[model samples]
Target: MADTIDEKTGTGRTEQIRDTSSSDRDFRLEEIDLNSNRDAKIKNPLAGIPHDALMRNVEDFAREREMTDLTDLLKKGAQIAQRPSEFETIEGLTDREREVLRDEVLHRWRQPKALYFTVILCSIGAAVQGWDQTGSNGANLSFPQEFGIPDTEFLDAAKTIPNPNFTHNLWLVGLINGAPYLASALLGCWISDPLNNFFGRRGVIFFSGIFCLLSVIGSGLSQNWWELFITRILLGIGMGSKASTIPIYAAENVPASIRGGLVMCWQLWTAFGIFLGFSANLAVQDVGRITWRLQLGSAFIPAIPLVIGIYYCPESPRWYMKKGMYRKAYNSYIRLRNDPVLAARDLYYVHAQLIEESHIIGKSSYLVRFVELFTIPRVRRATLASFTVMLAQQMCGINIIAFYSSSVFVQAGSSPRTALLASWGFGLVNFVFAFPAVWTIDTFGRRALLLFTFPNMAWTLLACGLCFYIPEDSKAHLGMIALFIFLFAAFYSPGEGPVPFTYSAEVFPLSHREVGMSWAVATCLFWAFVLSLTWPRMVAAMTPTGAFGFYAGLNVTALVMIFFWVPETKQRTLEELDYIFAVPTAKHMRYQANVAFPYFVQKYIVRNKNAKLEPLYQMDKNLAEGQARSASISEKP
Candidate 1:
């Protein structure tokens, strides 16, 4: 023990002789100097040294005294060096190991069954989004009869007379219906960030669920279109909140490996919800005027599950980290993961990555941050691509098809009931094909699918337009239009429908994720508003052929833009993508490709030689280190 003390004190140096063998293994000497300000050159007695350095010295002494092998010394040194700070390096974990750690952490928070149940619960919000959007489609089918409104003939006559009163009422109905979405978009921009900060993801979701419940009830009990419009506005507010927060919540909670799949569930349920709304509306179409009310009111049912189940769902560990609640974040990670050791490791890695990334992109005012989005060339390209894709999705005549399907059918010589049922069939087809999107999105990659589907959609729309040119007396022509509509919906399910959201969410950096997504959605809504407002007029002018032809033309334009611009984003992680596009060469390629494809590809492909793949390599290293640290910590006891 005397010789041990002498050696540990370093070469004949005398230090305080304290025996703490009786206490816990974690015992430490109070007088040992490990402060950062300690003199570096000091060799005097009681010279302050870092705890790490002292541990190394002690371990070295032990090795010399015991004639230990290098492996044994390293193992002993690791045990002695195990401190809070030593767990920071986790970038060395293997993919399988990281996944194991991720799973372990998730299991710690909740049972596997409960985790899956959370997915189902959160999907309610998704369903509500779908139902709300399409519910009006079916309602429009019966709205003219129920309200004693002029049918298309009377409305056309009313339009010709051009009485200011009749024109005002027409505009009023559009306002009442359109006003909510406008308000919701504005509110979404203002409320989402602050609400996320104030109420937490779960809280905001719960509050939105309450709003949905009330809106559905109010819409159900509406005495007039004006009253229903007010309810729709309220519902729109809820939808806006859902749009901003649901993806954030889902992204934050899910492990990276399964995140895309889990988030896609939101889209899946949304399609299902549309199907349900359309089917329900069809079932009650002949029942009475109240059928539309029942259809609109049924949106409330899903909110119950959201409100109840959200309470059990944990707040995002990422959000907790953002709040600097490291311990709380770790605990949440544990809940999400179900393993303390793995949770600790993941929590540290997540913290490090977030902090490092945030530091690189300096914290700035919201306006500055927004400006930065366009200032960075790569980010700009991504932003524009996102905006264009969403714009194309809305402008491609899907909404027109949805909102005026019954009217279209009437022109094609189908009764209102048959037309409404056909609309329901469209929704059902959309729902069925949505599953393929989930399976293929990650497997086949985004660019390939977009490239394939856009042309098909264009051709289908062209065929439908030609069908409209066929004489109204021909049943075969009408049959072709119906078949084409089904094909259009199916093609859309795997293409524009799910891919826009997926791409928008993927291309932005972590810091700009929420803002980018919000902007994309805002763009979608803005175009949707334009299309919705103009669609009735366009359909009336072109008599379906001109409108479908115009949309088909837009589809062709979208195909050209997508073929040159969008990159394959399937299977790649966000971090990996960030690194790939961070270089000057990649950045140039990204923008130039958007404008001129072949030249951009040639130049960028050559420059790809200079593209450094270090970030991905570093990320893999960090993950491995994290897993090893987790394993070490788990084995400590």
Candidate 2:
């Protein structure tokens, strides 16, 4: 039995009992000398190191890798067991020293002081989106009066002469509410790809910040609807580019473990900006003619931090690699990561993936590549994933609350002052709920959160619609409606709010990331344009109950799409994701999930099937089998 255990372990016995059985001594299995049997499965490279010291190294490696699972532990252990030449660290050190040093540096890389600050800085672009949402929400309350809008029933009363321009007035309001979104969709979707390719992520952010700054100022100073509309168009262009650029920038810089949380900071800042925008609205609500103007212009404040802070940040190392600037990519990698060894390893994977992508695409024009995005199965899966997630986000009706919460409150029978205050409550709820997503995103995974929260959102929207059936002044009605609206925010914030952006950032390879994300964000802007242009008209025509009921139905569709189409992206390295997306599983998952439970399909259905038909899976299986057979023959000999 002892010889068999030793043989199975692929190690020789070094510590043996000397005739202890004759002396009535008990036999015990002693701890293996990890250093002696270098190829043994349970060997520890840092065997002689203090337990605390070894643990510290482990902790450091965990942080760099963003280690959240036992798989990470096993992988790291197997990696550490490799011989000196097999390691990615500096060549001179012994295997044990190299392992410990590699881990120490990885810890440093994970918590890099400058890189995190850079990520936060880039995320300010999202603050602009939030600021714009609430600013417009508040501004809409007062801007109508200044523009001769027939806001009250008195304008059509028998005693008063009817306004001839009421139709024109409503058109202008739709224009004002929707122009930025339209421009953002058109320009942001199309223009971001070229700008990102030509100038890089940091340059696009800086340019967008400037556009936001000038446009907000122009919006504030406008004397007529046209002036404000044109400025908003410019603002939309800036936001369009920024929205597409920031997430890519952050994802390219961080480790896969923390990448979801870090990229979600975009949503976090956006929530913060929403809270500030609402507060700004409340602060200037009594300023007479300038109240709406102040709200519109207050967005400029967040842009300053974005512009100043972006200058200090490094461009994505992947971007540098794509452009054939290897030295620059290496330097950026070093600056972004904790140690040169990890940097080298990460860069190696990035280069390999980029090369593979290039080989698959061959030498194609930008137009050809863009066209091929639809033609390639792997790339199309990513594109469709990004598009679907963005579509789901807009269809959920979260933006309806963000863009017109104040108006919804008024429609619910609250006074204008009460409506603005209630909007603030919505803003606070949005901000608070977003924090939990930062933790849950990387921990529980993306698909799980969407599956869990989307149903709550759909039901809550229905409840909100039901509230409109009650008498307007009743406390029960108002309280129930407000509770439902807040509940909708609670559900939307953690799931739809961050997932779309983070998921879009994840699905695309570096070669297509910029254009892919741009299109995804464009899809968001397009739907936002639809909702902004139609919501008021929908409410006026169908009543708030019918309008919200429509939104609830859309949420149901979104839930179906998410359950069927979206794959779990948590814990995967960006390069590794290339392989996963290449598999023809998304369509199969969608079909199976539509037929049954998605969780069961993911856990049991997919794993249980033999994948040996696929060439890659077949090759891997054959190679593994061959190795096992060879090992058995050697053992027999």
Candidate 3:
């Protein structure tokens, strides 16, 4: 063991012993002197730079290292052979891999896992909104007893009977049901933008969950209608704020490839929450007066995951980038994109866009930012598109079905128990149908879905109105009404229900996204308030038939507006769509059906032989070429 251990040191030990004849020539720690003054003067050199700048440097170093590694690998064979092959020089990847990598760098491929967990966590905010809406539907069945309204009067009244509080009670029900949206339309519209600016997208959503929890508790524990109304208003503030913020938040964090599907998860999860609410309602239906309390309180359950889970989620990189927190944005962008190359590429684009936006809206106040949405030609057109989609969504009257499902089923000639069961079925169908939009929204195109589904919903709603006109109530009549209602869910869920929120989120640029979306959500809340506040009176005055007929006609108007104004936003990057809305609204609207729509049909379909679409395609080609020429000329100066 000694011989083996000493064998390697034998020659070195002899040389050291020979050289140690003079100890002054020996190595010593003292000989290697430290500059004490210099060290003392600079205790922590990193402290001289701002934290954000330091972080940006770190990110830049990491990105450079990645690039260096890629460059070295690509040049390795060429350097050794002194001759670079075309195939070998393609970014350290094979031809097929290079193509895929190029697509990823361009942000074209679907990447779900990287952002899925975070997006789903954010979607719980939407679920909270749905829970409040549908849970209240079940709660309305029983809350009247606690509030001094008779079980068999007003909403539950089998036959019209004279009651002292009939008109007052009906209005009170409308107020209670519509209070959240009223608060959302008023208070929420004002707060959502400022809160988003001050606290960021995630922070506002976090606060929304807190508001939901506390307000739900207040609502469930209310001793009187006034108390419940106030709490419901608070709850509305939370829901309304979420409506405006969550979609943009999710959209900014996700890749544009899966953006529509992920953002539409807002509605998808809301439907899930509604299903939970209806199930909760069914569970407690026999619990006497406490049934309503349990139903209302159940909204708090989803708020738990929302508040707790959101902390683990990263803030939007675009939000950080907008605030000039480059390091934070880079870090977040990296975390959100698993591919380092793709992350670096997307971060660069975000930086470029921020600079462009700053140039465009220099020193503009927040109010001016909103005004520019109406005054700037491109932004104004986009606003109109967003506004119409949101308005159309609400005008489709899905909320009427959600808020008054119990009453509608009761009016359709079902017993109270049977009506409650039917409400559960409606909630299930609503939840299940939303899954299709997850697949179709990114595939079939938003404009097509809206155009096709609106007519089906209108016809189904018309049939529902016709069903109520049957003089004698029969199983066939009830079944027909139920079928129409189901069909409405089937059509609306995949199209109008999810598309509006997704579309509105997409059209607005980063600078005005929050305020723009807030306006859109305000439109939704306004219509929600309108429908909720007036439905009882409308049903009382016009009968259910005329009420549904009004909604049917509204759907038709929505269909027309969508066809004329809304552009197809399938498979396009968020920034790439600027030109689509840049044209004058008057010109586009005048020629859309005659010139644009046919070209869309020809390009997306009829690829082999299509003479009917040729003229339309040529017209569109000329229009686009002319616009490009004018833009280039304008820029040349």
Candidate 4:
């Protein structure tokens, strides 16, 4: 094992790290070959340096960062990175350090309360996000007539009188319904980079929370449709920025072992917010004209905890390190991890990887980094994958239901009260089903869950659309519509619903995280804007069956795109993803078409006894090779 011990981790630090200094380096050093496959392995940056030299370098790192007090810990951590099994045997190691190291592995999920608290705070922010998106859903039924906006009666059985301005009014209602996403796409998401740069994750969330609170209050108080549309636009600033920052904040502080499941709280709680929004609609459904206002304004409740509680949560350790605040980063890491050794190990490993990234990606202005997202090979693949997930999210057609479910129910022939109640059922199923992903997302994994569920979502959504053709007079017609819609939500909750946000959050190098996420969120929200704006017209032109069928076809297209373009990221450290995205896209696509597809047919479809599937990516021990996404599903960690 290259004379290095790894009692818990698989194998020892590789000779590849040492060979970097040799004339005949196998992997090119000009840039990490962030090719298209997960099979490519990266040499550990900490692999080969001699103990004394490494200690000297560690000392230099500590001194330069004004963290000299941590020099000894840093040196030990480098030793752990270079040789983990020998961590128990490292020179001058205390019993407590050894015990803590063991605890880190055995109690992977037994995290510090502070860490879980931080995740909760981030989840609350997501709840605020979900509440914002859906508050207007129930309000959509009542608010149009109050503000003279066009109604959906022309498209469905529950038609209002044919007004002369029906076409213009329909477009106007769509415009208002879609304003938040338009504002988010055009303005709010793009600004997240600068905001995150200036305020850090916590501060950006606080800023967004205040905006969310104020905007919801403003929506409730608006006297006209235009005023309400403007308020929704203002709300998008909060929604977009919060969406960009919270998952990243949660990802940065958590351990990689459970990162997916924990980060998934964003989707889980957001579903809860949606459910609550629907419930609030029912609570005040009988309160007369002001009921719409209550539904629109009640979203401010979740934002209250978000703005007030952010200060109590620790800032991201990576953010502090990026800003050159090593001492503060260490403190934050300490609070976030259970033991000092664990914290030290993460801090130093992340520091080393960041240094490697600077050499690979090159540090520069935000614009330069933004440019590099496409210019750099590794970052570009990440950009492509991030874009795919975000775009597929809208393409899957989940938002059409989310943004307009009540109206959809009314069109399906339910009474207004029955429609609102049915929408609540949709919300409940969405929230309840998301719970499974909190476990499976880490086990079955992000890519697998998405792959498995997309087809189900497609068929179910198609079923919903087709059910629209059933005669409205039959009691079975309304029941079937509600059933298929809920089924669509069920399929959506565990896969597309959470994967996009979580996947986008972790795919980029820290240097480009803010801007990369902005691009991704913008892609998602922009398409969402398109869907919200065009659905009224599309449904008007295509009928519910045609509209739903079109998106179901889109869901299939999205599934194909995901299989070809999206890489699995389950169980990977944020820093470790550099290697995951390094393989060229051509290489990744070739593996899937030539190797993965063949293996799938042999193993799952053909049921061949001897067919074996080989992993495409190879990682050094320093990156925790065995704990990666390449591990077999039946294999224990």
- Candidate of highest TM-score: 4
lDDT of each: 0.61, 0.71, 0.71, 0.83
Comparing 3 with 4 on TM-score, the higher-scoring candidate is 4
Q: Superposing all C-alpha atoms, what RMSD in Å does each candidate have to the true structure?
A: 13.1, 15.1, 16.7, 6.6
**Sort by lDDT, best first: what order?**
4, 2, 3, 1
Which digits, one per residue and each the tens of the lDDT, describe model 1 over residues 139-241?
Answer: 6655645655434542242125434354444444345445556756666544665577557778888888888888988888888777787788787777777
Candidate 4 residue lDDT tens string, 162-252: 4677777777877887888998888888788889877789999998999999999999999998899899999999888888889889989
- Write candidate 3's Cα lDDT for 1-637 as tens digits: 0001123243311111111112222211122111111111101112123323433443443353243333333232222111111223534444554444434434444454647778888678888888889877877777876898643455534357637777666677888989999999888866888898778888998888898999988899999988999999999888888889889888888876678888999989888888888888888888887888888988899999998988788898877656545456666866787544445556554443333334344434578878988876657777899889989988898988899888788777787677778888888999999999997998798888898899999999999988876653566877788889989998988999889888888787777788889888888888898888888767766778898999999999999999888867765456545545554566556577676677767766767355354221111232234334434443553
The 10 consecutive residues of candidate 3 with the worst lDDT sum are 12-21
Candidate 1 minimal-lDDT segment of 10 residues:
37-46
Maximum-lDDT candidate: 4
Q: Score residue 126 of candidate 4 by CA lDDT.
A: 84
TM-score of each: 0.74, 0.78, 0.80, 0.92
Question: Which residue ranges in model 4 land beyond 4 Å of their true spot?
Answer: 1-39, 150-163, 621-637
User: What's the count of clashing pairs in each model shown?
Assistant: 25, 1, 0, 16
User: Measured by C-alpha RMSD in angstroms, how accurate is candidate 1?
Assistant: 13.1
**Candidate 2: which pairs clash?**
109-338
